[model samples]
Target: MAMAFQSILPTLPCFLPASNLPDGIDAPAVARGFATLGAWSLDDFTSDAMWRDSVALTGTLRTFYSAATVSAGWTERCFARQVHAFQLNPDAARVVRPAPGLGWINIPFTFATNTPTTTCSGFVSLVRGEGGWKIWLLRTILEQFDGYPNVDEPPQQPPVPIDGAEYECVIVGCGQSGLSVAGRLQALGVSYVVVDKVSQVGESWLQRYESMKLHTPRETSHLPFGRTFTDEYPEFLSRQDLARGYQAWAEKYSINILFSTELVSGSWNGDRRRWTLHLRQNGEVRSIACTHVVMAVGAGGHEPVRPHYLGEDIFQGDILHTAQYNNPHQWRGKRAIIIGCANSAHDVAEDMVEAGLASVTMVQRSRTCVIPVEYMPTRAADTITTADRNQYSAPLALNWQLSRLHIRAQIEANPARFDALERAGFRVDRSGDVFAHVHERYGGHYLDVGNCANIVKGLIQIKSTSPNHPIRFTPSGLLFSEGSNDSHLPADVIVFATGFKQNVRDTVRQLFGEDVYDAVDDYWGIDNEGEIRGAFKPSYHGNIWFLSGTSGHSRYFSRFIALLIKAGVEGVEVPVYRGVPGKAHEVEEVGGRGRGRGHKN
Candidate 1:
């Protein structure tokens, strides 16, 4: 059915008039507009008149109402740069028509002077309407540093800190979330440092199992303003490959990262409006002070939420969390039962089967939403590809709606894949709401790469457990229920793939005190206005902020987080705009713009 539908796509009527085309557009006007873009200085962004004339007002009229807020975010990243000289080579410009009236243009440009020379080998997007050709979107990134491409390097050693030091901001992790916001701060010339307990930038990934690879494609996994991978790199990167990339990004950009350091505690100073942080560096205590603090520790804190069962002390052969599992080779020929059927559990089961385990069984406690790896952004059908989806322009609610429709169609066209899983007693949520699964629960789903095939082949067994009749530990295995008919599954080893605690606010409370924990909102969920809860925006505490998510999210929203911190440091008033309840079309400003934070690279 999908093939037949594709065959007739070219013959479908678009119903667009001839006027809504580039052929009817004024070529000279388009050229003149780009020339103006090349001539403008950094100061032009601050002028309201220039912004009004150059930018299309597509927020309330055409696309999502949040378009205005995104525009403001762009300004925060592009504003107040100390540029000695700027160059835009229009002769090298390339324009391609995406839709009837929309044009995507890429012009290689350079910013030289205030810092090391930087360049962006990309283009700006424009739309033609009654208002004429105007700048629809401008994506500027730090593509090349010092006229050379960013390259990967071995981990760089961190500098020892003074007994007491001062900085404008202090980020509390060195993973994707930490590096992302730190890179943005570096671009904005903010004084900051990234502190992590690990000794290296990508140590987090390196410590995971050897077979672990990214679910998302390489194009979507890049950090903000970081370099793209060459043909030598695979579409999906392994743990080692990603760790090398992170090390190189940090070294090339001169990101100040202090290794072997852990954040002990933080106390907010009300009168001074700064945070006094206590840190431990390789067993030595050090102190630092900063006006802004970012808990980039991640949406999942370091503390693992371990499950307890009765009689564990007697029955345990070997039990561990997924975080501690390395390779299945150690458990070769041993019976293994993995609890929780999330991504980690499925991946581990597949590994165990390949390693020739005596038996592999996954205990499912609840329903799981599953989708094939190909349905990801880079490999999806053309109608739902990354080119067709503009996360910045479209609202989250609209995106979710479109995603649901596309996913349902894809599954409908290939029913046998899921049908087989259901036949094997594996409960699958066919109506997979990927966004909700990610933002709300963070788990209860797995992107099928090779696990479903193993499950269907009977190499990996399934044991469905009910929450009402909880399972308990037996001497040799697990007891499904208390009744006489309850089944007992024997296992030589047990691996709990159960997920971590969902709320990072609790982690914040543990370090920053009880008042901060109560004052901050819940992290990592969709709020009323469709914005990510407690991220990239000011918390109720005023000076505290949080940043975490996937690489794509980190690349995009890091700028917003930095912008808020930059504004607060500079004493600028930020007015937050929110939609009116029950009035879908109505939007009003409600103190969103805070004084600190900067933009993405």
Candidate 2:
């Protein structure tokens, strides 16, 4: 059975002892071997390589340097240093004990150069082979602007008293969105605090279904200004690896995060030009103030939907949402019916069958665009989605214009991907590549990662959500409609993979009231500027901003949001780049909460 990672990789002072590691292997020595490569000249490293087969860049490394750059190893800017120091993180080294003789260990490292004063954060994967521990993967992302933080220090020191410390920004939801924003804010030297409803870092990843994985490649999902590689590349990231990385990232920057906390309510005090937030931790509530609020909650996975059903309360069998499902093995030998068809639905269905369930059926409420993971080049998505830290550091209009072109290419490539989905029964209108279809529509498609194969192999059954074949719960099981046909499927479990309601207004109303909620535009859509509707721009409410998107977007755009907040605070003019072609930029006044026409829940 898959278990929650109670103890992470062993650390010098903290991580519990790692299981399955060969005894007496020096970890710091192994770390130095990889650093040698990262500091080497690009030509010598790639021209006559030693042990290239074992090397692969993690998502974090790939985003900064492509495979070619990784092959080159080090950039021209980096060379042999005068005072060399490498710190081996004991608790942060993740062990991959697939087998006794065939296991690999992943270690995260940070090194500093003396002459030029450069610092880098990276991970090295080492395998225990005949020649002792050898380097398998060496990938690092250099921090050019700010030095890596004193990782020994804790960021928030959980349950630590806030004591009415006024912050410049208060970020809610410490998942990818929150952490990514914090990284950017930290790099920009913003006075802020990040708080999550969960007790621990990356509990969002841990609480997912046992088989849940990143549908996207690993390279694009890194936290801003930090290393985000997994133990292996191309392969889906494990919850354990992700959890450990997040913990390490939190430590590296000491990004201020208060876990086991909740922002019960927040209201913008117009008179004081700040937001008063009710923060609840350990059953005690305290009020804190901040000039800006970033709802860093992800675009999805919030406010999950348990679809209304007749007699749902009286259903004898177990009823659950995909968000709450973690153990499919526990439901072994039971008949299960999962409603809604998407990534979660397919993952849950396949997991049930693999866990030795008696039967499983999936009901498709609407067509989903299905794309193969292998369709794009390995890490191709990152090239388009990732904002070049240097490039984006330029003027905002130029950065977005480049972004617009990159996204257009993805949209143009949609026909082929959509054609494949149309051949699989997705409606013509619902077909597009990830950008034009999946991320833009919230989700109208599933990134096939061996999902369609299960349906083809008859391991999982499928049904429709058409009104003609409406699903009705009987005393024993479910009666599903199949066009003009009706069939009874005995189910001991009913799992709803129904997606979340993207109602930012409803969520905002609870804290700031209906007036503030109404001040924002529709939570999501392509605006007149061709940029995303709610992100990186002012929502209808001036002081009120919505910061929710993929991690790559957060890494790239959060800097702009920080600049906006900074401009607003320092009484400087913020050039409003409306993202429209041939239009001159306009300077907007940077104070007061401006209202907009937005939707109500």
Candidate 3:
């Protein structure tokens, strides 16, 4: 199916001076109009049959009204969480064109039942018709998190700290992925503890090379509930800055994190549907029990990949992988040869050259999709890819689809970025956009800041050859493949920027047992149900879960993971939601079908 979509921009009269709304849509007026309809929905929860009604709701309101009862427990306290979540600007309204004829804005609201502490969140779209606007579509988004159970401080039942800890949930890996999940779990009042192998929270970023800076912009990469960071960092932040921010986020939220902890083994309790994890802290073995266990360790750190060469023993010099690469301060006059052509390789080669290396060469083993940092605008998608779709308020799946369509267009529009590099024997791939390429093959791409410029300017040597080319070691340096023009390149240091073991299943197996590993070995790929296999969704294994991806993704989808875990803890029946209920339509154009990208680099 074509995954194309259009981002709607609304227009209202300019005479309205009371509010200055972006795209000229009277957001406050639209909000007030939906509030009136929200009250009316309580009683007149009726609409004409299906899509032919005076106001259409895409069947969400009909399905909600058909329910046997809507309220539960003590007094029904309702809360309105603005549906403009898709837009960063609070004053702007999220507009969408579900059908060619209908333009609706999502007005998300939630209601809570205090007794059992359950919440239901959804949205109502105010349709812009011939007579101003009227409430059209109403739907349920999520049951637990979006249900608005608390206001001042979120609803949370503090974890019970104890020796040989037993808890409802144990979140492993204290990186951003784990911290994001911990925040969501804490907000839901779920009893969960976060554990990591490092000594501090932001060690992951701090451990990277000193010169590393995020390729992504500051606003899009911001953590959930931390808008302050976006302002503090208007551009890409340094690794040290990111580390301090991570430590501060954990501190500000009172996140429960256990550092210097290693999981020796995890055994599944078939009868109880829980996990008994054996952990080692300070060289002492201890056991912790929990109903659910979330693995937050990503493919990047699970295992470093070191491809073998023919005669590595002949070379007597330092050859380090990018994983252990700290800085180039020592390799001042050394002849360094960086293997692999991905981002790390380019970055490392650039670092060597800038560090005043005698010579730096980057071997391009495969084709890669390289895009500049401008691909991600401060705002959302620029041109609408499909008329049937909307970017502001679509289901995440559909949004992913639309995003790919939009990004593909951006690449197609600009050919100058890759043309010269390709002419210079560089294999630039247009098989898909950078986003899809990353998900499909983690190997192909670098979001260039300076490396490409150096490659073009003859500052960095480029060798376009197969990754498995024969490499033999010589006493002085190394010999390249016989087929290549340059048979030898003297090098004192070789850094492998090759990828790591991305199999989440294998990584999980190493932490748990084979049985646990077997349960989720087929980790990444499209599943039978059409959902992305393994990460946020439940794996083949029960209770065991995965949390991996960029920080923004972790921030957004952590709620779903927390809700599922929360369901198990509270013993509440989770209602079936067919992909975040909304009016965003699927792309009708077949040509628009493509892959997508994540928020983080």
Question: On residues 1-601, what C-alpha lDDT tens digit does candidate 2 reach at each position?
Answer: 0111111111101111123556766666555555454444433222211211100111011111222433433332233233246665655565544323344566766666553354555555565544345444444433432243322122333222345478878888877677766766665555789988887788888988778787777776676654467546345676766777787787776778888989888887666778889999999999888888888776633778765656666678888888778878877998898887678888888888888999888876655555566653344223432334333322222223333344434546666655543444433233234454433456645777886767766777776554534457776677766667788777889898877876565677777887777776566544322234565556546676667766666665664565456545655432231221112153122222343434332
**Local distance difference test scores for all models:** 0.63, 0.57, 0.57
Question: Sorted by TM-score, highest first, which candidate order results?
Answer: 1, 3, 2
User: What pairs collide in candidate 3?
Assistant: 5-386, 57-137, 119-147, 120-147, 156-189, 157-189
Deviation in Å, model 2, residue 569 alpha carbon: 2.7
**TM-score of model number 3:** 0.72
**Number of the top lDDT candidate:** 1
Q: What TM-score would every model get versus the actual structure?
A: 0.72, 0.65, 0.72
The candidate 3 region of ten consecutive residues with least summed lDDT is 49-58
Question: What is the TM-score (0 to 1) of candidate 2?
Answer: 0.65
- Per-residue lDDT for 274-316 in model 1, tens only? 8899999878987899988888877867666667888888885
RMSD (Å) of each candidate, 1 decimal: 9.5, 15.4, 10.6
